[model samples]
Target: MRLSVLDRSRVRAGSGHPEALRDTVAFARQAEQLGYHRFWVSEHHGVPGVAGSAPTVLAAAVAAATSRIRVGTGGVMLPNHQPLVVAEQFGVLESLFPGRIDMGLGRSVGFIEAVRKALGHDQEDAADFGRGLAELLGYFTGDRAVRGYPADGLRVPPFVLATGAGARVAAAHGVPLVIGSFRGEDAMIDAITAYRAGFRPSTWAEEPYVVISSTVAVADTAEDAWRLLVPEAWAMAHSRTRGDFPPLSAPDDVLAQPMTSRERGLFEQSLRGHVHGTPSEVAKALDHLVHRTAADEVLVTTSTYDRAAMLDSYRLLAGLYL
Candidate 1:
């Protein structure tokens, strides 16, 4: 099984964006050493906990810092920028990194209305994602009326960040699909099936390829692994209630906080499908998940309050299959 990373460059409670970004670069190097196939950075605009607003920039840093490991976005939200500009930026990255760059694009609007306005985007912009993606691809393949300059001759492997409509867009374009299903297993299977059924044979890919991204953590004990997930889960719950995604707190701190019934419900919802346990247990669940989803690769998107423990979890998970 091919294991990859999708790092959000998460800012912990006490750490700032600089520390989180530095950790992203350092973690990419470690991931390469640990035999991860690809390292992807995600883009989240106006989020306090996430520092990866500009994934292409972060991808460039990661690519410069590490060799051999494929570096790219997990992805760049396409509606946030013009297609030509997106093409040019990735074109430059591909020129710098050559065969090691992946252009993963998504169709998400900003997290909130203010953020959407700041990006000069709205829900209507998301409606034009397919058209934007087509334009982006045309620039790469040199098939459009407009040119992408340095990117014209480049062959950056494009993958769509799979959401509901995004999966179909990937199928229509014959690019790979990267879906995050940390909520349910059945949903992942349905997405893959839909992609395969609608996939067209384009030069980009002859057949459908799927990459599943999920929260995975491994520790010496099952209980300990669950402990490592608490911070992030609590953060998710907090986001639902407060309309802001806060930086992760310590697991003990999260656990000690009093919760209302609604908060408790949301917290439990966040915990679903988070594959955390001992190595053997996590391995078994991941195997089942990969098989069920027919995933060509699995992207581990694990974030925890404990940075050292996060590294250990990746190391152990890598040992299990890498």
Candidate 2:
């Protein structure tokens, strides 16, 4: 199975956004060296914890920093931008990087009502994602009335970052589907089965391709690996209860804090679905997950406060599969 990475450019408690973004670029170079298939970045608007707001721009930095390995967005939310503009931006990326670029698209609007208003979109705009996707694809194929200059004939591969009705949209459009594994195995498998059953052949993809996006952490011991997940879990729990996502704190520090019943519940819940263990243990879990889902690729999206530990976890994971 293909092993890839999706870095959210998450900021650490002591770090700034600039450092977070630079770390992403540097991480991409390291990922290429580790024999990873793809190194993709994410987009999060006005989120304090996430530094990767402009994915295409960040992708350019990553591409320039690495000679090999596919680079793309985990995704750019279609509801927040014009389809034509999205096409053109990707076109320029394809023009520069050629076969190395992947255009991963999502249907999400901004995180909150105010942010959505600032982006000139509402929740209802997500319903128009299917139409926007069609228009974006049309720009590359010359099927639309207005043609995008560099994009008209460029064959940049498109992948749908599946959420909610995303699998259906991907099936109709005949593109690869990138779906998370956090939602529960049965639900994810059902979505994949439905997507394949409804898939229609198109120039982008003749067959249904599924990439299971999951958080995986590997270390010398199972306990150490589990510790690596603590910071991010706390951040997620904090976001749910506090209305804002803060930077990752040290796992030890996070563990020391007293939590309310709600925070504790959410924090523990955040840690449950992820795969975290020693190298051998993690290998078995990942193998089983891939087998169960029949996934074409495994996109690792692990994050932590300890940069060294995070890198070590990735190295151990790469040793297992690469």
Candidate 3:
């Protein structure tokens, strides 16, 4: 299976945004050297633990830093952006990076009400996500009234970030679908099956393409890999209970703290959903995931408090998967 990298630009508890972003760019270079297919960054608004608020801007930096790997947003939230603006921003990136840029779009709105208002979007705007996607795609095809400048003729392969109804939308557009593996194997199989069955031919794609993103970590032993996932698991549990996604903490500190029954349950559930183990173990799980979902590519999204360990994890996975 083809392997890709998805760096969320996660900030550790003690580190700042600048360091997080620098790590993202550096990680992109490392991923390229490791023979990964593509390196994508994400977009998150008003999240303290995430430094990737503007994926296009970060993608520009990544493209400038790397010469081989394709760089783009893991996605740009469509509900939070104007279609023309997104088209133009990615158009500019495509102008520079040419065939090496992706335009991954999503249907999500801001995580909070205030953040939605800041972006001048409401919950109702999410209903227009399909329309926004159509508009953005139109710009590239020269069908829209307003041109996307350099993007009019350029082929910026658009991929939808699939979740729930997103699979249907992707099928309708005939674009590639990018889904997360945290939703369980059964759900993933159903979504990909439905997408392929309903796909319609378009200039962008003639067949179904699925990219599965999974939280993965690899180490010398199964126990060590699980230890590396603690910080992110704890952060997810904290977010569910506290309504905020805090920066990752040291695994030792996380394991030392006492948790409420609810937090403990959430933490364990989060841990269960991820793929973490020794290289052979991770490879087995990933191979199963690929066969089950018929995935065209697998993107690994792993974050830990220790940068060296995190890099090592990627290297280990690349050695096996790539």
Tens digits of per-residue lDDT for model 1, 245-280: 888899999889999999999998888778889999
The lDDT of each candidate is 0.91, 0.93, 0.91
Ranking by lDDT: 2, 1, 3
Candidate 1 lowest-lDDT run of ten: 182-191
TM-score, every prediction: 0.98, 0.99, 0.98
Residue-level error in angstroms, candidate 2, position 18: 0.9
lDDT per residue (tens digit) for residues 94-164 in model 3: 99988899998888888788888898998788878889999999999999988888778879999999776
Pick the winner on lDDT between candidates 1 and 2. Answer: 2
lDDT of 2 by residue, 11-51 (tens): 99988999999999999998999999999998889888889
**What TM-score does candidate 3 get on C-alpha atoms?**
0.98
Give me the runs in candidate 1 sitting further than 4 Å from their true place. Answer: none
Task: List the candidate 3 regions with Cα displacement exceeding 4 Å.
Answer: none
Worst 10 residues of 3 by lDDT: 145-154
Worst 10 residues of 2 by lDDT: 109-118
